[model samples]
Target: MKRWMQHIMPPGTKCMCIVAIVVHLDFQSRGIGTALVREGTNQADQDEVLCWVQSSEAGRRCFENEGFEEKERLEVDLDKFARGLEGLEERDAERKWGTHVWKYMVKFPRQVD
Candidate 1:
């Protein structure tokens, strides 16, 4: 099945090509997320750029185990951020779904000299 990241990625960043990972929900706790992360890091091993991802709270441990660091925390004020929008737009989609999204960034830091 087609996933959200499959369509929204910044081009050339799929599977083992780019240094990013986008995991699916149903397959999350079964090591699929870790494998995807490993693939990104494997790519980073050969490429100049580092591997990076934004994961949910539940996925933090898998990423941390694979050597990803928490770069920063992200917060969004849906109501404020969604201001000046018409009814039932992308901004209002979250309200309809009744869940706010939070992301913890995971990055394979560049080696320091």
Candidate 2:
């Protein structure tokens, strides 16, 4: 196990996962999200880690700007997911985050000398 970890992990890297990345609604359209993600990727670069994120459209834009690449995309039909919700029509479902999924992405940041 120790040998396995050493071989797979770079010098300073460890197991790291970013389950969620959200900037405040008030901070939207600003560069806050990009900065946050850039910092995260920068750290990953130093640690020799490859970072992953499941990003929505806007979130996708942020990561993409920072050089993340899409590995996969998943879309959910809310009508199927919601089944029998009284007020959520298929069209209405389009308007909610509850109906969508991210394109899986990974980022490899440049190593600083």
Q: Which number leads on TM-score? A: 2
Which tens-of-lDDT digit does each residue in 14-79 have in candidate 1?
Answer: 332233455677666788877877766766665645455566666678778788766655555555
Instruction: Give the candidate number with the greatest lDDT.
Output: 2
lDDT tens readout by residue for model 2, 1-113: 35433544468765444567788898788898888888888888888777777678768888888888887777886555555565766777655446577677777657779
At residue 89, give the lDDT of candidate 2. 66
Locate the minimum summed-lDDT window of 10 residues in model 1: 1-10
Candidate 2 ranges with C-alpha deviation above 4 Å = 1-15, 85-99
Estimate the TM-score of every prediction.
Answer: 0.49, 0.70
Query: Could you give me the TM-score of model 1 versus the true structure?
Result: 0.49
Q: Tell me the lDDT of candidate 2.
A: 0.72
Off by over 4 Å in 1: 1-26, 79-101, 104-106, 109-113
The number of residue pairs in model 1 that clash at the backbone is 0
